[model samples]
Target: MHFDFTDLRLFVHIAEAGNLTQGAAQTFLSAPAASARIRALEAGLEAQLLYRGNKGVSLTQSGETFLRHARIILRQIDYLRDDFTGSDSDTSGHVRIFANTTAITEFMPEVLAKFLASRPGVTIDIQERLTQDIVRAIRDGTADLGIVSGDVDQTGLEAIRFSTDRLLLAVPEKHALAERKSVGFADTLAFEHIGLHDGSTLLAFLRGLMEKNGYDRALRVKLRSFEAMCRMIEAGVGIGIIPESAARRHTKTMRIALVSIDDSWALRERYVLVRSLAALPGAGRALVDELVQNAAGGRK
Candidate 1:
């Protein structure tokens, strides 16, 4: 009843080899040592675990019952060790990432796919939030990495430029602006525009782009999600501005036409990689490297 795992291992070894000498050879123990271990286990369990004969050894009735339990225990320990060891070198632990809807839907999937393909044992948890929420998650230690569209003001975060995505004007295929070669800031203002929420970094960037191009009025919209923006455009509710990547993905199958904006504004917005200024785990570092390399290679 008070047996340790070594006793159980001795029992299993004896069961498989059916003799002390052979079992000792398999386990790298001397024959005498292996015999002593089996004798000690039998004595502790108060069961004659083996019957010695001229040719070999066979299990007694009590040994037959104990062998079943012994094998199960050894297998369980093997599994426990394998699980712990895997978490070390194989990047088998959990990693968390935060991003807004655009980054999650359009960009993060491709990056995650590549990371997962290489580190198949690792599990990733992704959370979608607005830009401010994404930064806040990193600052609060709730997320290991953050993907956001614009600059974050948090003090202890390290940000790196990964890729550039252009912001585009999209309209329903039949809409008047759909056929235009390009739209200017003044031209956009004349339309009932679809836009992200005022708090979104996309909205902030769009506002700055408008201001830089000398548009003095507010851009109007009833929703925040690109899907919602698409729905509005499909209904001809208004023309909308969105990341070109998003437009390309969601609108390709829809009746939408994407147009470029010709303004003095920064034509491309950045997709930035952010992590705590504190040290990152090896897995996180690997992920960051993959993301930057993929970005440089122009993958999504």
Candidate 2:
């Protein structure tokens, strides 16, 4: 029921050498030592593996079957060993990303698609978080990279500027604020508004702005994505503030009105943050490069 790998190798050497002594020499074992091991192995299997004669030993049908299987098993073990011994440049692991809501909804999808197309072995895990939380996660090593916006303290991280993000007021085409060329964040608070789902980074940022500025608040609905928020705004659910890129993009096909925010805080530059870009693992570096390239060329 059980035989060691040594027994298999010894049996194979003996079969190729055409005798026990020569096979023992090949395996660096004495003839008597090899004979004892073979006897034990045969006993364990309860099969006569060799036909011992004056001309030397030859494989019985059982020995032939064992040799064939032994070679296959040895080859697989060698492959496993080689895989573990491969270099760190192997882009075959997981890459963790923490990003803000706009980066997750409006930015990452196309960029990630291009990155994943050629890296069949690479996988990505992304989570949406507030900018400060994303920065903290990257610093603490829980995340490999982060996409964040606005004036966050980046004292110990590597920040690579990737894109500009501007928040705009999205309203129905015939809504009260639709004809306005621009509106202040405080001005929009008087009307009912749509918002992102709870825990969204954009919603948190907007809430902070509303608290800091003198503005009444009314949130009638909360949805998951910018697309959904735009749809709600178009349906006259309420006006919502979302990324300008999303608002403009959605306007091409939806009856949504885009109103510029006069507040300077509404426009912020987004960055890719890492503890140290040069020290990233191969897969991580590749993804960072993909993001930088996509940003420079602009995403479709």
* Clash list (residue pairs), candidate 2: none
What stretches of model 1 exceed 4 Å from their correct place?
Answer: 1-90, 195-228, 263-278
* Model 1: worst 10 consecutive residues (lDDT sum): 269-278
TM-scores, one per candidate: 0.58, 0.69
Which tens-of-lDDT digit does each residue in 1-300 have in candidate 2?
777778877887898678999999888899999999999988998999899999899999998777667654553453354357672353566677989888888879988888888878777879888887788777766677899888889999999987788888999999999999999888888888789998988888887887787555557989988899889888998899988888889999999988999999888988889888776666778888887788789662
Can you tell me which runs of candidate 2 are displaced by over 4 Å? 1-86, 216-218
**How many steric clashes does model 1 contain?**
0
Task: Report lDDT (CA) for all predictions.
Answer: 0.72, 0.82
| Residue lDDT tens for model 1, 193-239 | 77876566567656776787576756656575788888888888888
Alpha carbon lDDT at 232, candidate 1: 81
Measured by lDDT, the strongest candidate is 2
